[model samples]
Target: MYQASKQRYETMPYRHVGQSGLRLPAISLGLWHNFGDVDRLSNQKEILCGAFDRGVTHFDLANNYGPPAGSAERNFGRILREELGQYRDELVISSKAGYYMWPGPYGEWGSKKNIIASCDQSLQRMGLDYVDIFYHHRPDPDTPIEETAGALDLLVRQGKALYIGVSNYSAEQTVAIAKVFKKLGTPFIIHQPRYNMFDRWIEDGLTDVLTQENLGAITFSPLAQGLLTNRYLNGIPADSRAGRSSSPFLSPENVEATINKVQQLNQIAQNRGQSLAEMALAWNLRQPTVTSVLVGASRLSQLEDSLKALNHLDFAAEELAQIDAIVGK
Candidate 1:
């Protein structure tokens, strides 16, 4: 008996994916961290519903998102079935396959067998007939690009996915596979890259390729895995991701290396009347080729804070230059 806000679409902005007919909200919800078996279902429902109420129509997931693997999809599927089933057509649910999922050789990589089988398994876990956009999680050095692109095209033909994308691909890799997808007549629409003020690798060449190829780009980790947020300004909290011993990505040394830069950036964000997180998210969207930014929040308040970045998406040239100087861009 949950009701979505009638004013959901009033505040959120939607942009077309490249030159395609599909569009996505400026901020898409990413279920990478909190929507897992270890988390409570009620909390998950609350966050999901809160995001939808604010016009987050796209929910990004992957086959290996959960620590236990596939748990996030199972949890999200239950939430969809028990709470938001009525809003299925109104939402764009995306899932990717490219990381480790199972025990044997067929479990990982971008081979034809792995890609197709992973999509099927993801669909089953999510209790869905078709996902809006399915992505190849990463490039497989051992597999032929042709096989991977062919598998995605096959998924579209089988009616399992509407559009296709690739994540963590370089400019060269994207151009190579894009040609194959173009020849196959696959509706390859988007590329998911890790981009933020701290990570500028995509700007080196990927953005140009995406723009040239007319492919939309959605950036993951737009907050630089929480480094761009205010959480670490005073030092890492005992409960924060950086404080956790098991977190492979954010380490104490890494935080120490970038803490001063983060503090400097915070001052700039304060001058602009925005939080560090808001400015970070806005920075990624400044690129016209970037269709959307994928963000994950453990609570409704965090999500609300992220949505505020839309208020000041416009940045002066001086501000951009200052940011680049502070981050050593």
Candidate 2:
């Protein structure tokens, strides 16, 4: 009997996905890091429930999000059933395929077999009849774009997914698949790419094409795996992700290489009356094509700190330029 706060929607802002009637919260929760079987269920409940209580209507997931590969969704399914079952319709749940989940040729990528089977597996793990948005986790070099995009469209037709999206796709790849999706009459809406102060590859060409193609984007790694935040300002802590996490995404050398820029950014964030993490989150949302920023938290405090980014999403011309100079953009 956990009652959500009545004011959950009071402070959170929702942005419209590109050219679509659907909207997502400005800051959505991502289950990429925590929420696996190795993590505590009670803590997971606290974070998920806490997010919903504060109006994080979107929760991003993928088939390979867990250490054991499907555990995140399985744990999420339990949370949904035991804690938030009554509020299902109030949430925007999304999952992705295209990553290696099981052995064999059909275990990964964007082939129709992989896509459809992965979706069914994901749905079964999460105990859901349908997901609001389903994505191809990444582009497949060998698989034909038409086959991948067509499989996604088929999901919508089969009532397994509502909208379609693609992640980790370069600008050209996005355009190619988008063209096929248009012809198939798919409700292709969003792109999930890595964007942050330390990583601005999206600005290279993706943002422009997102506008041209009328697709929204939800940026992941917006904190640069916690680099943009104050977490590394004093050097990497022993308990931080870079310190000991099995995830090879971030390393100690990576933190050391970027500490100077991070410190400089922190000073600028302090000047703006916001933390570095807040400014980083706001920076991603600065793009009109960006509909939301996907963030992850291992603790309630971290999640709370991230949510405060909404308090000041605006940045001045000088502030933006200073950030660009610091991060070498």
Candidate 3:
């Protein structure tokens, strides 16, 4: 009963994942927060459909995305079965593992057992045979880099995943794993890091490593988990992410620390004829290695607003310098 847009690809841009042949939409949808069972199924469907209608073909997920665990994938799987299954090849779906899932020792981390099992569980939940990209959510301090890399390599060999990626890894850790992946001939092509105007840690050394290894980066929390948006320009609304007691990453003190800079950034965005959110997302895409900007949109309007970032991805030298000065470069 659902129809896709005839002009879906009219405006959206797709960027290559490093040197790989694959390309992802510049603005990919992330089901990190609101696609779970706690949210309305109707809202979720609307957002997903709206994204695809705008040419967003990639959807990022993880095993532990739901508060109840695995609910986001289930809900998305239902949406796919009923609405988008016919377009499976046109979509690039990714899921990650590394957080706690079950209770036993094999329940989490980057071990061969946990990684493979988590991928299987994700595939089952989504009613799919293989995901486009599978990621190890984070580095395990205890696991050897070779072992973790081996587990991911095995996923591709077993036909459970097409490409391998890692999230929240350091430059050194990435290089270590890349070595093993290269030897095993794994198609490890992407890295997901928490990057934003406020959080520029990826710029330190990770960007260089990614460039050298030819591994693309898709950034998470590009808006500093909602701080770079207009939601907190005046004050944190009761419904805003920072106002929620559950996600303490953006506490009142954190918002206070960056409010001045955020306001300045908003002014620059207004000058560029974009909202703060659009400018913030464009800032992340400005990085050469960032193949896509992965963000969560609970509503269709938010997704529409985000898609506007593509309109003005270019920045003047003075604008860049002003942003750097405001964020204390």
Worst 10 residues of 2 by lDDT: 241-250
Error of 1 at 234 (Å): 2.4
| Cα distance off (Å), candidate 2, residue 270 | 0.6
Local distance difference test, per candidate?
A: 0.94, 0.93, 0.93
Best by lDDT: 1
Error of 1 at 283 (Å): 0.8
Steric clash pairs (candidate 1): none
User: All candidates' TM-scores?
Assistant: 0.98, 0.97, 0.98
Cα lDDT tens digits for candidate 3, 54-164: 999999999999757999999999999988888899999999999999999999998888998999999999999999999999999998888889989999999999999
Which RMSD values do the candidates have, in order?
0.9, 1.2, 1.0
User: How high is the lDDT of residue 236 in model 3?
Assistant: 75
Collision count of model 3: 0
C-alpha-based local distance difference test score of model 2: 0.93
